[model samples]
Target chain A: MIEFRMPSLGADMEAGTLREWKVKPGDTVERGDIIADVETMKGIIEIEVFDAGVVEQLLVKEDEKVPVGTVMALIRPAGETAAPKPAERHVYETFKSIVNVKEEIPPVPAPAHEGLRASPLARRIAAENHLDLTTVQGSGEGGAITREDVEKAIAERDIRLKPRPAEPAPTPAASTENIRMAVAAAMSKSNREIPHYYLETSIDMSKALAWLAGANRQRPVAKRLLPVVLLIKATAKALREFPDLNAVWENGLQRKAEINIGFVISLRTGGLIVPAIRNADKKSPDDLMETLTDLIPRARALKLRSSELSESTITLTSLGDDGADAVFGVIYPPQVAIVGFGGIREQPVAENGLIGVRPVLRATLAGDHRATDGLTGSRFLAALQQLLQQPETL
Target chain B: MTEADIKTTIFQLLKRIAPDTEPSTLGPTDNIRDTLGIDSFDALQFIIALNEKLGIEIPEQDYGKTGTLEQLIAYIKTKER
Candidate 1:
């Protein structure tokens, strides 16, 4: 017997409401059959199966929310004399449905495929409104649909479209207010309650930067390494030695783990987006650079599908504007620490009893005192500057 | 606009938002919010006011430490500058 589990629709989204069930118990289902619909963070998505089998039980009922790995249904071989090989094959098979249902009025009823059947009106309305009927929790007998169900689905769908109304400019305010609310609550608490201490350091990147320029001239367009990438790499490596900065302050206590770095990329329209590069501490500076440059453009455009917006524990904000020498960044919430990168400016400085114009960046570390102290934070920043100073060892 | 002009305008707006507000004795040193108890919800109200008063799209990312009147003025001043 094969257990048909609720599919993982997004990276950070763990569970979803079972909007509806297209197939029922004892229904003969085939490979690629629409088994049930689940409502995830993105929207309603149709759930399908890859193995032809007999439906023995529906573990989750309509309108019930279940975790990503929760079993929603059970499937067995098509024939009475069944084999276990088909079930095994489907277990390892992972495929995602990318159908965007936009026509709210519904389309010609999609054939039930096997024994499943839906009203032509319900199908057409679903296709027109872009509602995935799999998610509609049918109140009718044998899990059939009713007119009220379609209206309810539309009301729920209307929430995302709420900001797109008569006024265009205020809509951005509506959208951005959500983000500000989250940010303000955090900064206020950090400033008002949490004991925070800030430390600043400067990094000299002449040698490593010269190497980057030469390497970029020889590398392909997508393969070039940027300075921000090297900074992330150095920060990650240093985090390994200074585990205290990677800790989180929660429940009046400190919790430590390997930190993921969120790179804050500004969108052209005004908003800023943070995308996390997971387990970056172990990756080389060059590799970190490549990932940062690649992920930033995608994230900034809001092109990230549900799965792309995964979880991250820490972040890095860079003000690499063309002419600016330095910029400060605010910390993202629930994160105990955030590192800022100023524009690498050329300045004269004395080193080893001699002074020369060198490329440098003013780095700032704002940390929560509950998790880290000024000494630990300073040492961490010092180690980070040291790593950026020498890239050949990384 | 001059830096002083921007500061004056922010102060004027902040003054109107908090009528019970005392004459702002603090300058760049004072927290933009502490003088008025401007919590997160107040920040949204301020953004709405700024949008109406300034004809700008003040993104949330551009706001975080916008706690001090100077910081708010700095943000508005920089946007125009």
Candidate 2:
């Protein structure tokens, strides 16, 4: 039996509430099937199972928040015979003790004023009326207080106290604050743990941009490629030569087998998410663009699959459109390196005695010093520059 | 299709690509990216959606021409004819 644990979606995610189960006990699941929806501060993400098996048991119930690596379910591997009853009992007893150990470590108690299950609107209404949320009865799902409940409470209170004018309700700020905290925790951990080495290079993109314009002129807008696509492709291609940069630094450097490039996309609300473009090196420019177009929408909507969230071998961040001259990204942990691209701008260039204004892009690499040195990072950047120069090949 | 019909169709397409956009606030001359806050990816999806819906192919060279709602509608109207 293989235990399916709650996979860490990102460095920031410590725990996730198992919102819903797409599969039940005794259900046969295939690899890549979304087995559950996990609610994190980011949003509800569909968690995909990596192993194909029959779900032997559901260890964690829906709506229970579990820490990363906590076993959520047990899967019986396909073609494996059921264990004898006595053997099963022995396994169950061991599992029970493991769970008991977890239970022994008491969780941080919720604050007195914050533990009540009240909606933001309800909380606001109760606060405006000087009503305590714990005293207000909830009528919504999971016995959470709704706006109607607050209104009902207000109506009952109005009979005893003088009616006051209702103030405009405060907007919900929990999600934004939560995201900020998550980002803070992750960045702090990265800074404290990872010994980072930063490298930056300016690449002349006049040829690449010109080539792109000419190439795009022939294709329909739907099939048109962007410079970012080329950047991703070049980065992926370069990783093949400098595999050290495309690795995670745990106790030792663990080089990733596939080149999965994570692209950081900033959400409209607040914060950002790095979702991977799986097997980016294998995709054509058109295919990469299509995947990117599809990925961005789903990512913003919080509909990204678990694999997209977790399977990045290295990260690529671009502030090109945002007009940043350069970016030095904090390496997301486990993943040792992050490549950043700045806006392409026309700059004076002297090439072999010829001087002209050309579009230049600043690319930066932040790698774990333990995993790779500056020479390796520089070589990777050099390869990337060469790839961008030959845009047709990308 | 009439210009009004084209505009309506474009709005529907934009709504699909950017569901968070408030249609009431959108103006004819407003830049979709600036007004609706959609990135280049969403912009490409919008172009793809228009192509699929109207059976018209928009060249990448004309991307600048379709910056505003009015420009996009006008471009589509001309293409439909």
Candidate 3:
């Protein structure tokens, strides 16, 4: 049997609460099927199973918060037997005990609420209102507290303390605060550890934009390409020439063969998420645009998969239409470099011995000094500029 | 379609693109995209959806002209003729 553990969604994530299970004990699941909805500091993320197998057992209960690498389920391999052997069960039992022993003690006394059962929603409501679960009586199966019971308790309490202004309803700010904290933690760790070096360059977008407008004129609005797709493709192609910039510094510089570009999508509420467009180097500009169009909505909805969150070799942040002239991004570790693109604007340019107006874009790179120096970064930017000038090749 | 029908259709399309938007709260002259916080990608999506549902083709140059609610309604009504 293969152990299915809780995956660390990002470098900042330490634990995630199992919100709901999409599979049962005997369900057959394929790779990339979303098996559970996990609640992390970021938001509710649908967890995808990486291995195709027949699920043997679900070890963790719903609403249980567990740390990274904690085994939550067991799956029998696709070609394996129908059930685990007796010896395997014994080994599983021993492993469970060892894990249980290492768990931290709860803030509440364990004996007080022993054998007490409450619905997940009721438990959440109680915690939000600071109402003790032991005090609220359950009216569910086996006398477990239902959501109504918690609501009734809250109502009664509100009546007892009437004449005061009603308490404000819970807002999305709480979750946004959680996301802000996660971003702060990751960025602080980045600033504290990584030796950052900054580089900036400007590329004229006359040829690229002209080609794009002509290309878009024949297409429908749904299929029309955006300039950001060209930027992503050019960055990916440039990485092919400069291998060191496409590496992560984990103990040593480990260059990744596949180019997974983590494009940053800012949420409407607040904060941002970087979800990867896998194998960006191999995708055409149209394909990249489609992937980006789908990715932005899903990232905003917080419905990203596990691998999309964890498997990015490099990150890209673009300050679209209304942003500043240039942006220098912080490198998200263990990824060694981040590329930033500013808004494209018309500016006076002296090119080919003539001064004229052309659309110009400022591109910036922030690299970890330990993994690469200024020369490699300059070459990468130069290559990126060269690649953009010939948009048809991309 | 009548002007009222166009208004209703536009609001429905807007709601689908940005779920949090409140139609009653928006001023007629206010920029729909700016007030609703719809970015460039979503704006393009909104336009595409409008084209599919209303059978009105909005060109790239005219995208900026349809920013406000009244402007979009008037534009679509003229096209429906």
Candidate 4:
């Protein structure tokens, strides 16, 4: 078995946004055939197969951004198990640690005769109810034990399965909520606590618009100039010079490094998610556009894997014409800064000592004051200003 | 120390680290904010301070659950065990 990893797009790139999967799992492929399209820091790159046989499994799906060395797909010569052998990377557990208890509990050993392969949680539910899992057949995918199986077992019998009268329903024992619920709690806490200082700067967008218009005229309509792509390009340039802005404030420690960027997208059903653009500070405008557009939808669906959500140094939030010129964004905690991109509007502004109407857009940077001072903020904004001014370079 | 002793130690630790916070209102069941009001940023600071004071590491991954005092106590006990 061979593994295909997310190749670094450029020299400075530590990761690439998994933009789109051109091929699905179990697809046959040849060497040099385009397997997936990855949006690298440089541009949207075609992930061509080096050795061809069968794409046994896609370790990553389209729109999931991953680190450079992360295995995105695995290929087998003919037939091989996609399941990463447990020996290679079982959840390494210390005997006891605070972090361990909260993580996914280990899967319990299965009962051989029962033939009811149950996850740890399902087995616990069954044991708690005194329902014989052996009598109940699994209806889940691939004969896996599901909550429904236990429920069915309970229903098929006429016996009352309630716990002893003295136990008192475990009193909603542990008061444990899912991790998603924890995220909600964090959001509410952020809104209530963070004294978010919003600095909105409307940049002259005439150059970007003109440059994009001309660039689009040269390229296909399917790939046109979008503001986000341009913003990525411009922000990348700004972050390159002011890397301090790209930081995380962890337990009295400010982790200042890579200029990864996270952008928000609202889901079709409900709620919002922020999927990050890995190493945006290095990606070209076209590449940034490709990464942002693809990953935003995946993020909204909560389909982004753990890899995608992890390791972002900074983030961006945009309301996209939902409100006025500026959006005061909440800093995605741990991250030092979040930039908000508001809708572009035509406004009169002074450019090169000349007052004129130009397409301008509001860009706000909310930074952790402890990490990035106003001067560093000024440098980032100034660098951004300098980048936007050079539409010719983009 | 027993799990209950560790919980009490944590409750005491919280007060020392977050000087502005008075956790006398805190209980095993009470939410962190309901007991002693803490916003998200404040919560982050509190976690950092708690870890530093205890000389225990609370990785960023665990901070989500450890935000509340009740949860934090549970987390520390799990670690001590």
Model 2 misplaced stretches (Cα beyond 4 Å): A1-39, A42-62, A65-181, A320-322, B1-4, B55-57, B70-81
Residue pairs with backbone overlap in model 3: A138-A144, A138-A145
lDDT of 2 by residue, A298-352 (tens): 8777667766777889999987554578999998877899999998888999999
Please report how far candidate 3 places residue A237 from its true position, in Å.
0.8
Q: Give the number of the best model, judged by lDDT.
A: 3
Please give the C-alpha DockQ score of model 1.
0.02
Q: Answer with 3 or 4, whichever has the higher TM-score.
A: 3
For model 4, the interface Cα RMSD in angstroms equals 18.8
Candidate 1, superposed: residue stretches over 4 Å from native? A1-189, A252-256, A305-310, A321-324, B1-81
Q: How much lDDT does each candidate structure score?
A: 0.62, 0.75, 0.78, 0.59
Clashes per candidate, residues 3 or more apart or on different chains: 25, 0, 2, 2
Better of 2 and 4 by TM-score: 2
Docking quality of model 4: it rates as incorrect
- What's the lDDT for residue A268 in model 4? 29
RMSD of each: 16.1, 13.1, 11.9, 23.6
Question: Residue-wise lDDT of candidate 4 within A181-257, one digit each (tens)?
Answer: 33454455455544455576778888887877778657543344455677776786677777667765555536556
- Return the TM-score for candidate 4, rounded to 2 decimals: 0.46
DockQ of 3: 0.39
Question: After superposition, which runs of candidate 3 have C-alpha atoms over 4 Å from their true positions?
Answer: A1-39, A42-62, A66-175
DockQ of each model vs. true complex: 0.02, 0.30, 0.39, 0.01
The TM-score of candidate 1 is 0.47
**What order do you get sorting by lDDT, best first?**
3, 2, 1, 4
Best by DockQ: 3
